[model samples]
Every structure is written in C-alpha cells, then in structure tokens.
Target chain A: MLKLDREIRDAIVAHAKRDHPDEACGIVAGPEGSDTAARLVEMVNAAGSPTFYEFDSTELLRLYREMDDNDEEPVVVYHSHTATEAYPSRTDTDLAQEPNAHYVLVSTREHGNSAGPVEFRSYRIVDGVVTEEDVTIQE
Target chain B: MAIEVRIPTILRTYTDGQKSVEASGSTLQQIVDDLEANHSGIKERLVEDSGELRRFVNVYVNDEDVRFTGGLETELSDGDQVVILPAVAGGC
Candidate 1:
C-alpha cells in the first residue's frame, strides 16, 4: 500500500488545477523507508497535450542532484490527466523507467464542485506492466 | 459480443485518429488480428513481425497488465478495456 500526506495530495491537486486543459507533471521525494512520508518536490507543465508529456530530464537531473545534496532520493513520480480519469495512460506505463519508484496520478476533471474530489491513484510499472496499488491519503 | 479496444493519442495517427475501436476476439492475439484487418498496420506498431510485443509499448486489459497474465493469449470478456500505452519521454 502507498500512502500520501495531506499536504502532498493538496500540492498535487493544486498543480493539476493550475495546469488545467493540459497535463501537469512532477516528482515526489522522501526518505527511503516504509514509514517515509513523500512530498511533492518539483512541478511543471507537460509540454504537450493529454496524448504526451515531455518532462525535461535535464531538470529532473538537477532536481535529483538537489535531492542528493539534501540527502533525499526521489521516491515517486507523478502526473495529471486533465480531462481523463486518474488511470495510468499507455504512455505512462511504457515510460515508467524507475521500477522502485511509485507512480502517482491525479485527475482534476470534476473541478470546482464540492463533490469533485481529486482522484489519486498509485501504480508500479515494471517490465511494461502497470500494477495498481491502494493509496492512502493521510489527513 | 465484441470487445472495445481503446487507443491512446500517440498511436491514433496510425488508426486515422480513432481513439477507440471495436473488434471481435476471445484472446489478445485475435483482437490484434481484427485490429490489423481494419487499421492495416496497427499490429505492426503493437507487435513485431516476430510476434513479440514492442519494447516501448504496453497493452493492458481492464487495468490489469496482459504481460503478467497470459500476454497475447489473455482471454477477454465483454466490456474489458484494452489500453495501448507507449513510453513517454520528456520533462525538465
């Protein structure tokens, strides 16, 4: 099971809403432990539409280096689906290079309404297979 | 009944901009054949001529990965969702 803190979930939702009509992408960094609470590190707008997301690996390398400097490692990678559900896209499954990393997705479709809860899902992509896991968001 | 195959955006260029298509088959291979019959070259994009899935592509049935199940032989029932996902590279 994967768990997220309230602040992290809110940060992801905020990023998704900020990039509405397009995709938003980011990574999560934290300690390497089961009890470690992940936090959203860097957020960016995906350069393309829902069909594609171009995360600048150069920026990622910088962030990775920064995390290294901070003594933290990226533990999760996340992105948002603007008009789609919080399900892993085919592109997401194929590009999942970090098997040990948790893949998180947030759906911001039903925005602005009280019932429009942000949908968050986590997955582990290994060898071209995406395995869904139960995600617990701590309040 | 035929199952519905949902195509993602990247591969839609090959399917003439079709986002979702319907095909008849019980197994994943049969569905691929049906897709090829209609789209002509979709099979080549999803699978190699040697009958192996492309390294950059992934097929999922109802959110469960076909690779972990039976791969091309994975049985399909009505309303099963087949998602073809390719690797996405980009970000900074």
Candidate 2:
C-alpha cells in the first residue's frame, strides 16, 4: 500500500489549485522505503503552465547531489490534473523514468468548492507500467 | 471468475466517471473487450489503429508490468487489480 502524509496531500491540492485553468507539476522528496509514513523533505515546482512542465534535470541533479552529500535519496515524484481525475495519462507513462519512485497524482476539479474535498491518488510506475495502490494519509 | 479492472482518470469520462470496474476475462485484451462492450470508446482510447497500446499508456498488474510479462496476453486472476495509467502531458 502507498502512504501519503496529510501535509503532502494538502501541498498537492494547493499546487493544483494554484495552477487552476491549467496543470501543475512538481516533485516529492523523501527517504527510500515502502513505508507510506515517510516524511516529505521538499516540494519542487516544474516551473511554468498547462502545456508543459520543465523538469530541470540540472537542479534535480544538484538536489540529488546534495542529498547524496547528506546520505539520502529522493523518494517520489508528484504532479496534478487540473481538469481531470488523479490518473496517469499516456504522456505520463511515457516519461516515467524512475521505476522505483512513487508517482502521486492530485485531482483539482472537485476541490473548486471550499466545502468540496480534494481527491488524490498514488501509484508506482515500473518498467513503463503504472500501478495504482491504496494511499493511507497520515496526520 | 471475472477480473477487476481499474480505470484511470482520463478514460473515466467514457466510463461515466468510474474509477474501477469489473470485467470477465483471462487476459488483458479480453478484459478490454469486455469493457468496450459496456462502454464505447474505451478501446479506442487505450489502443492505436494497429491494436498496439498507445504510446502514452501503461497498464500494470499489481506491482508488475504487463509489457514485461506479455502485453495483451498477460494472464489474470480473480481479485487481481489492473491499473490503467496514461501519460499526462499537461503541466506548468
């Protein structure tokens, strides 16, 4: 089972909301483990709009270097669907280079209402395949 | 026994917003056919004109990948979860 922290979920929702009228993308950093209770270290935006997400491999490399410098590894990568549900599209599957990393998708449609609840789901992409797992959110 | 198929977000519009559904089949292709019987346009979204999985789509069984196993012929069992994920291209 995949586990997500409440804060992470909120962050995903907020990021999706912030990018309303378009899609939002980012990365989730944490320790390497199957445990869903891992603490989120950071949320880095892809930097720009609905048509494209620029993942600065250089920045990611630097961050990875820093993490290596600190003896840690990046755990997961996350992004959002502004007009759709929390599922991977064909484009998403094609670009899933990190088979070991968790792929989290947040849906921002229903959350438009202040009273509406946010919808988020997590998955694992391995060898170009996407598998959805139950995500347990921790407080 | 029938296998349980999980629908991804993008295809939900064709499935009337269903996140998961049940289909009777022993292989991925059969399951997809069963789904198309109930919901039109599903197979089109998942497959190309030549019957290949779309470039942006990924189907997984449990934690294993269907492509590495057998593509459309991958075997299935009752209660097994099949996840359909399409590559998401939109982002800022």
Candidate 3:
C-alpha cells in the first residue's frame, strides 16, 4: 500500500486534468529509504503526446542530481492516461526501471478536464511484472 | 585512463550495489567494455545487440549527454565522471 498526502493527490489530479489530451508525467521524491511521497516534482512531458510521456533528458539528469544531493529517491512516479484506464500499458511495464517506486496512473478518460472523479491507482512494476496496490490518502 | 561511472539504482546489481565504480577507457565504448569485463551482463542492458545505446538509456560524460557527443565513440579522459540513467518514460 502507498500512503500519499491528500494535497499531493489533488495536485496530481489537477495536473492530469490540465494536460488532458496529452499525457502528464512527474515524480514525487522523498528522503532516501523513507518511502514517503513528500516532494512533488512536476516535469515537462518531452513526448507531449496523448499516448506517450517522457521527461526531457537534460531535466531528468538535473532532477536526479538534485535528488542525489538531497539524499532522496522517487517514491512515486506518476503519469496520466488521458483516454485509457488507470493501469500500466505494455510500454509502461516494459520501460519501468524503478523497482522501488510506486507507479501511479491517473486516468482522465471519464471526465476529461471536468471536475468529476478520475481513477487514481498505484502499482509496483518490477522486472516486467506489474502488481496493483492500494493507495491511502492522508490529510 | 580511469573514469568514474555512476550506476542508477536499477542497475546497481551490476556494481554489486555500489553507486559508483571506476573503470578504464579512452572512449565510451571501451569504458562499457571495461564495465562488462568487471560486471558481466551489464553491457547488454546499456548497449543493444546493434551496438547502439539503448533508446531508453541515457549516458552522460561529465554532465554532457553522450548522444550529442558521438555516442559510444565519445572520448573520455582520466578522472571523467560518467552517469547512466534509464529514461523515465511510458505511454498508454
């Protein structure tokens, strides 16, 4: 199970809504070994396609260096599925190299940019295997 | 020439959990070969059978992306730092 702060969850949903018709991707970094998703680092979607999302290479390097300097790790790696269910696609599972991260998928298919509920789910993708897990929001 | 290679968490298995290791090479390809010589099966993850860097893997030499610096043929010098990171990517 993944415990996420309520505000961060809302922020992720909002980001997904804002980027509707295009995929949005980012990571929440926290102190190393903490497993607590504390810092939400929004990233630009270099692919900028509804069916794809990739962090810019330069930005990716900077992000990692910052995390390393702070002794942090990406606790939650998230992306939005603008038109699909909140689940890992074959591409997601295949390229997910972060074995210790909580892969969060937010699906905006039902409501698009509207204020209705969206499917927010979490999973663990490791070694080409994806296992869904529960997400508990905390105040 | 000794180059310091920083390994990502996912590829730490190849470095026996050491975040960074030292290898010798005058070019990126030779460094990879040296890495494989010390850590078998790691070259396959960084380089494809076609001998090109994997699409989802990013390699940097002293903060410059190897892609723009001749890729596998990028020259290296002693005390250079190399960092390898898998692309943070996916799609639906």
Angstrom error at residue B60, model 2: 32
lDDT of 2 by residue, A1-139 (tens): 6667778778667766777645666656554443333445443445555545445433444554464455444465677676677787776776665555677787777765243566778888765688998888778
| Model 3 agreement with the true structure over B34-74: per-residue lDDT tens digits | 99999999999999999999999999999998999999999
Worst 10 residues of 1 chain A by lDDT: A56-65
TM agreement with the true structure for every prediction: 0.56, 0.53, 0.99
Instruction: List candidate 2 segments past 4 Å from native.
Output: A33-47, A112-115, B1-92
lDDT of 2 by residue, B1-92 (tens): 57777775457777887868888888888988999999998999788899887755667776465778888888888888777765433341
Residue A73 lDDT in model 3? 97
Interface C-alpha RMSD, model 1:
12.2
Q: Candidates ranked by lDDT, best first? A: 3, 1, 2
Give the number of colliding residue pairs in candidate 1: 8
* lDDT of model 1 at position B2: 82
Comparison by lDDT, 2 against 3, better one:
3
Better of 2 and 3 by DockQ: 3
Question: Looking at candidate 3, what is the lDDT of residue A59?
Answer: 96
Q: Regarding DockQ, does 1 or 3 come out ahead?
A: 3
